[model samples]
Target: MEADHEVAPPNLADIDVSAWRELETAATSPQSGFRFLNLCSVDSEARPQARMVVLRRADGPSRVLEFHTDSRSPKWRELSTKPHVTVLGFSTQTRLQFRLQGTVELHAPGSDQANAAWDKLSPWTRTTYTGGPPGDECGFEMIDEAVLPKPQDDAKGKPHFGLLIFRARTLDWFQLRRQGNRRALLTYDETGALAACRWVNP
Candidate 1:
């Protein structure tokens, strides 16, 4: 049985365009509890790769989403080869699942956009990219995590840090409810301009 305080069933007849607004709002605000998404890309061997990434920025007007990563990460190579990617995310609070598809643009540390994002990172977060290149081979001996080199300033790890900007072309939004489900696809043009928003079978 559902809890007494659970949200009431949704009405499929009504389509809420605010879903996109809510998603952007949630992604930009960490307190909203929807700041994480699964970023999927295709590797050199044509295999799909997926990983959880924090949502750094979401611009509805431009249909762009930004996230941070280490320059040496495997996903970076994959994305460099195949710029197209799919992002899957869910908000447990709203019971909404979003499938986003987009092309990626990587910004190096010195770029204004990358520098702005780098300046906002806390010391600890910056330290994450300070270690040896991601995916480097380790010998059979155990290593001390405490002795890892730490970056003293943005300049130290800036070379290894990267910012990934995703230009979204489409979004498939699905809402789950006990009574019924609702789904819609919001498509954008090559320039990231909204082209159409239409409802489809869940």
Candidate 2:
């Protein structure tokens, strides 16, 4: 039995489309809760490493997501050694959670894709890779004034700028609402084709 005003559950087709639309919006909308996600990977010691990363790109059709990082960063090294990773994000506004398991493609600094992305970055943003390698100790004053790439030296951090391209193989999507809760597992094949969809208990 259902209440008169209870809303009907969304069909799988609708959920599939709406979920991707949310991801696309999350990538471009700064205010979106999902704009920042937790990316987790395994280090050499087989320990787990998790960091907050901005969602730089999300292509629903290709099931690909992108994030920028310094090649010298520990996470970059961890990813290079083990490409498999998990990404998680939640939106309080929508009461939605997305957990995606995937592998990553590293785009080196000088690669065509990396170059195009680097060219679009503002000088200030590019300055991040100019300092000493990530995890290096630095004084607050030095971080604020020193180690910044000179404005005219646009190539200063080119060698350290890199991109992590995530190709999701599965997505666990969940939504909570006053009236009802829903969950689904969507699996994608190597070509990014939806191979399976299953609704689960919320």
Candidate 3:
């Protein structure tokens, strides 16, 4: 029999389910701690580059994730050169951290994936891609304009808008707690099937 005041510890299966559920929630919820991921990639100079990217999509069954990016950004070029990346996110509320290693697939302009992602963007988000190239100097006066998501304006941004699809090869999940910490590693096969799951020391 269990003690009345004792709490139940989650098993491996429960932890796996919870991790995926949190990821799915993070993709849709703005207030989610995991909504913003720190994406790291290697640059041409063999140095690591890190940037914060929004979590646009999460599919647990397929072990896939997606994020939108400007096609002209340096990260885009770097990722194009080396498709491998590390994505990290954490939730203070839950004390859970997710670190994912994966290869990214870029969907260029007019591609089916990019088109679908672009259509889902709100008018305000669509305006982000209308500006000058990312990381470019403001050579001219930066005037403020209420850029509405007009068809033409949206068209200008379309060429710079692209989608990055991440297929996870492994996931490292960790939970921090006062009493004790827990960690687990989940690996996926080439076909996106979960190949193995095991708990590790935190």
Indicate which candidate wins on lDDT. Answer: 2
lDDT of 3 by residue, 1-202 (tens): 6542355667866776788788899899999999999999999999999999999889888888899999999999999999999999989999999999999999998898899999998776887899889998885547546634565576678889999999999999988776667789988899877789898888
Taking all chains together, each candidate's TM-score versus the true structure is: 0.83, 0.90, 0.90
| Residue pairs of candidate 1 with colliding backbone atoms | none
Give model 3's TM-score versus the native structure: 0.90
- Candidate 1 lDDT, tens digit per residue, 1-202? 8653375634432333455576578766886645888999999999999999998888777878889999888999999889999988888888889899989999866889888999898887887776678778867464777665555753578888899999888888888776667678888898766688777889
Off by over 4 Å in 2: 1-5, 145-150
Residue 36, candidate 3: Cα error in Å is 0.7
Winner of 1 and 2 under TM-score: 2
Locate the minimum summed-lDDT window of 10 residues in model 1. 9-18
- Model 1 lDDT on a 0 to 1 scale: 0.80
Inter-residue clash pairs, candidate 2? none
Q: Which sections of candidate 3 miss by over 4 Å? A: 1-8, 139-152
How does model 2 score by TM-score?
0.90
